[model samples]
Target: MTYHETVIIRAMNRSRFTVQQGQAVILAETADDRPLKEPLRDREGKIALSGLSLSELKQFMKSLGEPAFRADQIHSWIYAKWVKSFDEMTNLSADLRNKLNEVACLSALEIATLKVSRDGTRKYLFRLPDGKLVESVLMCFQDRDTLSACVSSQVGCAVGCTFCATGYLGFMRNLSAQEIVDQVLSIQRESGKRVANLVYMGQGEPLLNTEHVIDSIDTMIHSVGIGGRHITVSTSGIIPGIEQLRDENLPVTLALSLHAPDKQTREEVVPITRKYPIPELIKSLKQYVEKTKRRVTIEYVLLKDVTDSEEQARQLADLVRDLHCNINLIPYNPTFAEDGAALYDRPSRDAQVRFKRLAEGSGKTVTIRLERGTDIEAACGQLHNAYKE
Candidate 1:
């Protein structure tokens, strides 16, 4: 009845069902891919087979007059083997592959632009089927023997954090579960290294697109062979999503993007903080830790003169002192604001050291993160996308 709903109805006519209000994509969930009153199709009237669970695939195969085990073969070929098209699924009979080609596609990201950093970081700009672009990064931390990848959940972010580059693009539609999983797969196919760790911290806020993000996690865990423990869901302090994640009972780590120490400063840094207050968020986080028995990661970005002062650092130390967590001190990555003004600066190295010391004094494990791909504009808070008109 509303204008946004009417617009969403119009969009459904062209592609898979997405819940949207203006440009902000809302979350609509399907527990087992059961029939909704409005059946969701994949883009272009096809069922994106890549996002389907094995059982759903079995149901689809049955509908197609194929054996149930065919789903198993297709699943293995798509997720494990990383095939782009049905034609590459050589094990399937030609007849079946041809039939699948009519109604299903493997994944979305087609046009990939790669950028390599001096620090052995690989950043990709991938074009979705709808021609929207999103970024994902792969970093090989050889010293720690960790291959970490970050994937986007939405085309652009709605949260609009003051310091993030993606925030400037406003909001767009959420990515399908297939799209989210394919990012990691694309990285693997491009780099020839299986990502040991994954983070949902690129482009958009993962929690805003909760359903697809969770489904992507399931696919990553069950099919793509990434352990849930190695997965980190970084939120810009979305309390409800944090609580929902706790209820999901997933083994993935939770990282809070608490950019500032207090309410006033936090609201200035992260606009969403006005909706979910810091106290309420901390309460929810405590409950999450209590329920999951997992230690949280507190992400505090050190902005020069703004969030780097001794008082704010001490306040940050006291704020999480009682909480069960480790701290990641991210020295601000320089990015020009939308007006093309340098409104923020990275904290001096001495300031970073002092902040780390204060956090460590709280008996918390703390590390000043070594950023990668900064020279190539691919580091944290540095990803943005727009299509030329």
Candidate 2:
């Protein structure tokens, strides 16, 4: 085998995973070679068949005495054909299909609710196996459909950004790599459209859960056929995650959720800033640009009278000036309280114009994002499981 192939094989051999529960267990080849009567669960849990890598699937098939080629067939069925069940693999033998039915499942998310906006933005609240809710969004444009597919790395967020709704919910457990990949498949199945783009800017900090994020990236690129350039993984300034991304050498776009420019203003909103801090974060981002030779995006949420002032804009421009990056200014999409009060005012047209001009004047690329699904609460900082039972 080639050197790269040998390295990949070694990595695959080292990787350990479990199947999701309730699937029949594959019997090991023994003197009897008899199938077990009861279903088996992996030590971690039963593997959800949909997200298995080709390598993982090969290992699984081997335990069943199935030929190694069967793994490729299964991979094609799951990733290319988008099969939702083992029975869909018409080429597989009936006996093999029956064996798979006992031990594997396709997806773990149940669609709790879906809300569509007049502007063609659709928000989804998916109920997980553990009864926790995570959200994803589909945004349709005239030219192409960008399934924001805002996937969560963690159930809720630990960053606690004051403007974000998910932060208020606090942190839950991290999602498995398969769980992350399943979100896109589930959405595509429901919407009857292929996902054109993916953003890891949903509910949780992706960098904090880098391993699964990287695995999901692999599945999306190799299996789902999403281009590396089209996938954007946003982080709330997690320095370690940034370093990890740099080292991994993946070409996916990196977006820094830099809501505020100054350290004081940043800490007030994004609590994670106190730990990583803006200067250190910027320094790392510069190194990332040098290493990857890719332009990063600075995602700034424009809150009225808060982060949209002229001085803040200038400061923000200065902060990112040295780095090869563009700025995306998203206006505040407020989450209201029970008393009918908005958490933060949306930036005024004049304020947005002034901020954009100031940042652009400093020789930086800037864009004031047009609002989509704000009426449906599918905009930034608005995805926090708004569905009830």
Candidate 3:
């Protein structure tokens, strides 16, 4: 393997991961997780026949006394053909199929609730095996022929950005890598359209759950056939996660949730900034660009008087002047509440236009994000489990 490829393998952050409560157990998320001593099982204790990486599947097939090549057939059947059951893998022997039914299961998440925006944005709340709920969004753009899914890496967020909705919910736990990918699959299964793009700008800070986030990206590309370039992982500026991702050397995009331009202001907007300040975050992002050769995305949320002022606009422009990045200025979505009142307001249209112009003048591309599901509080920063049951 190439040096970077070796680094990619090393960066998976693999460790001992326990499985379901009942019978079998296994270790096989990353290549470094070692050859398994037991069968791979989901949280329900059945040997999990779903969501295995290509190499892990091969190891699994070898364990069953099946030829390694059976991994190809199973991978193709589950991911490419989107089969719901092993019995549907007609190529497998009937005995193997019966055995699979007895000891293994295809764990698909149950849809707890679905909400549709008039703008064609579909938001779904999914119930995990342990009954924890997470949210995913599907947006179909007629103009671009793009179907994008915003997926979560954790159940809720720990970043605690003062202006974010999910921050109010606090952190529960990180979603497993399969749980992340299943969100996209669930969108496709329900909408009957392939998701052309993925944005990891959902409930949790994706980079905080670095290993599974990268693993999920691996499955999305190698198994589910999504292009690496089509995926974007957004972060709340975790320096360690940024450094780890830089080593992985994937072609996916990186978006920094730089809601403010300066260190103090950024710490106020993106609380993680206190840990990884603007200068340090920028240095890490520069290293990321040098490695991946991918332009970083700077996601800035514009609050009415706080971040939309002329001075802040100038600072925002100057901040990204030397970087290979674009600016996406998002309007404040009223998800953060105080005593039943929305805590922030969207900046006036004039301020947004002026800020975009200022940033564009810095030779960095900038666009004001169009509002999507504000009516249902499903827009950016609005992905807390509001529809939780």
Candidate 4:
């Protein structure tokens, strides 16, 4: 069977499940059905309450025999005050706090590993409840006084980008909305600062896991109070997923991982392109722009010799010029070779400048992404694979 066929089969398996209790325990077997291990739930089978908005928290409190006004107090302590423990919520009565700690648990993901690059970028590896691992990265731009956290939506990538190390592990599973939101919170806790922006560009394709990703974005915006416009979701041309994102009418930025301009090149590098071609992907993106009236971002990773040529740059420029969008050129991060072949050769500074100039000449906004956390392998496509090796 082709790789595409295999991916479809896996997705089908994931979707055929019935949950037991409040937990996401899937029951598949007949007679003594076994509980499926949930990825983000704490040992006590609870997820962090941090992602719930005031309204959602009110609804939840009402369901649990508490007054809705208590939700406002909970929200303040969780998001505004950033209380680490339940006892630290001083405004909350000691009895109520004890009750909350008993019936409802505060879930948090443990930091399994952390690596800081000489460039000051921080990458954190978090261990989920099921023992599966996912990563979140913090890119700090001291000069600009900006910090952005790249969060993952899945443990391993299903998109199978040939150049990405995350794809090597294949598809493990989709992360819950809680898992996605926790990555952002965990990063903030580690840095002791609120992130200026959020990017869903780590580990997996954000679009492939649409429901959880959108729910996570909603929580980040409405609950966590992060501005929707400051958030970006990066996808490798998942057509249906893009259409769903547009229908949501959210102001979050949509970024397409348009690594290559041509069909053959794109198909070779991003296997999903074979299923959703550039023409179709462009149609979805245009619809997104028209619906949301927000500029889309086209993320192009420059691979040495393969796609860094002037011809490729011109094609990329032409491809995105018509769409109301910007181009973010990311230098390729080195990864372990499939056959011991070299792939780390990033484009020289001169070549990157030339490519940026060419793309901008097409009247589209273009920005070159600075490589972050390379020394500690915290740069893009550089995590998890080391653990595998």
**Is 1 or 3 the stronger prediction by TM-score?**
3
Candidate 2 ranges beyond 4 A from true positions: 1-10, 13-46, 145-148
Question: Candidate 2 lDDT (Cα, whole model)?
Answer: 0.80
List runs of model 1 lying over 4 Å from the truth. 1-45, 338-340, 386-389
Task: Point out the higher-scoring one by lDDT: 2 or 4.
Answer: 2
Worst 10 residues of 1 by lDDT: 18-27
Using lDDT as the measure, what is the rank order of every candidate, best first? 2, 1, 3, 4
Write candidate 2's Cα lDDT for 146-170 as tens digits.
Answer: 5556677789989999888888899
Over the stretch 10-64, how does candidate 3's per-residue lDDT look in tens digits?
A: 3344332333342234555545645423333455667555566667677556656
On the 0 to 100 scale, the lDDT of residue 53 in model 3 is 68
- Native-structure RMSD, model 4: 7.3
| lDDT measured at residue 26 in model 1 versus the true structure, 0 to 100 | 14
Q: How many backbone clashes does candidate 2 have?
A: 9
Model 3 clash pairs are: none
Give the least accurate 10-residue stretch of model 4, judged by summed lDDT: 10-19
lDDT of 4 by residue, 243-344 (tens): 888877666899999999988889988999989999889988999899878999999988888778899999987887789998999988888776967555
Candidate rank order under TM-score: 3, 2, 1, 4
What local lDDT score does residue 252 receive in model 3, on the 0 to 100 scale? 88
Predicted structure 4: clash tally: 0
